[model samples]
Every structure is written in structure tokens, then in C-alpha cells.
Target: MNPPNDPRTAADDDAALRALYGRAQAQISAGTTARLHRARHAATTGSTASPARRSWAWPAAAGFAALFALAIGMQSLAPPAPPTATPAPVLAEADGAAALDDGVADALATYEESPDFYLWLAANESTLLAME
Candidate 1:
């Protein structure tokens, strides 16, 4: 192996690489070599499709563009859909207020009947707050 500061020139390195490449190429089978040559030739020649074969693409593209424009035009010309008439919500404001009042009254009656339960809840709430 050469040292970090080897004195080899670029030309020497390129020559060595070429020699290695030549040896590798010699090892490739003839069939593989022929396939590689055919691939390279086809790439260089570009697409082999005849003009007649290629001509259909333009008409197909134009047809697709016309369909897109027609769709847009029809959408713009059509009348806007009428707004849907949704039935009003079943619960009215007054009904909701009455229900809330009833719930509050029931809760007050329960508290009045079970003051001890409320006290226990309050005591437990203080202990829970301290834990937090």
C-alpha cells in the first residue's frame, strides 16, 4: 500500500485503473458483451417508434383537455343547489332553562336531606387536593 503522501501521478493512477478495467472486461462472457452493446446502441438511437405510432398521442391529449374544460364549463353554468331546510333542534331555549332549574332544585333537595354526605365529599376533596 502507498503511504498517505504517495508520490504517484494522476496519469499513473488512471493507467492502473484502465488496466484493471480491461482485465474485468475480458472476464465478461461474449453474450453479456453483446447485450451490453445492443443496450448502448438503443439508448444512443433514442426512441425507435415511427411517426405514425407517435401521432395518436396529440389527439388523445387534446381530447382529455377538452373533456376537462367541458366539465368546468358545465359546473359554472349549472344553478346553485337550493339551501336545505333543516328542522330546528327539538330542545327550545325555554325548555332547556326549565330542565336546568329542575335539576338544580333536585340537587338542593338532596343536599338538604344528606348534609353528612356533602360533608364527607368536601373532606375527601380537601385530601385529594393535598395529594395533587
Candidate 2:
């Protein structure tokens, strides 16, 4: 290995690398060289896309823009949708014993069905109070 601080060694190394690169470059096939040249030219000229492909870009962009505009226009021109109708809340009757709402009637029916639970609680009331 060349010394890191030696300028002569660095120069010699650079020259050797350049010579190696040149020989390898010279060994490349003509077809490969032509392809490399074309690639370099295309990169430098900034024309990687074919003319046919590039031709469709503007039209495609315009078509998308037109579609977006049509969608927005249709949304604006169309009538506003009618507000959704919700069921009116059940109100209590003026008289105390009149017809009850379905929810209240169902709760009353459930309590009536579970009379055994109420009876058990009544029997255990004194014992539960004593334990507490």
C-alpha cells in the first residue's frame, strides 16, 4: 500500500487507475460502446421518453382535468338532497293512567315477569341489612 501522506504515491496511483480504466474501456464491444454512447446522449439531451409516449401526456392530463371539472360542475348544478326524516319522540299523555309509551310498557312487563326476584329480595331484606 502507498503511504497516505506521500504526494508522489498518490499521483502514481491516480495514473495507474486511469490507465486501467482506459484499457478496460477499450476492451468493451462495439455494440456496448454504441449503447453507452446513445445512453449518454439521451441523458445529456434530456429526452429519455419516446415522442409517441410524450405526445399522450398533455392529452391525458387535459382529459383528467376535464373530468374533474365535469364532476365539480355536476355537484354544483344538482339539487340539494332532502333532509332525512327521523321518527318523532314519544310524549307522555296529560292524564296519569293513559296509554304508556312502548319502552315504558316493555319495562313494566319485564318487572312483572320477574316478581319472584322481588319476592326473594323482600324476604332477604332484614338479613341483607344486618350483614351490611
Choose the strongest candidate by TM-score: 2
For model 1, give the 10-residue run with minimal summed lDDT. 2-11
lDDT by residue for model 2 (16-43), tens:
9999999999999999999999989999
What TM-score number comes out for model 1?
A: 0.36
Clashes of each: 0, 0
Q: Which ranges in model 2 have alpha carbons more than 4 Å from their true place?
A: 1-19, 45-51, 92-132
Cα lDDT tens digits, model 1, 1-132, are 656555576668889999999999999999999988877887798845355888899999999999999999999999999999997767687799899999999998988899798899999999999999
User: Which window of 10 residues has the lowest lDDT sum in candidate 2?
Assistant: 91-100
| lDDT of every predicted structure (CA atoms) | 0.89, 0.86
lDDT of 1: 0.89
How do all models score by TM-score? Answer: 0.36, 0.47
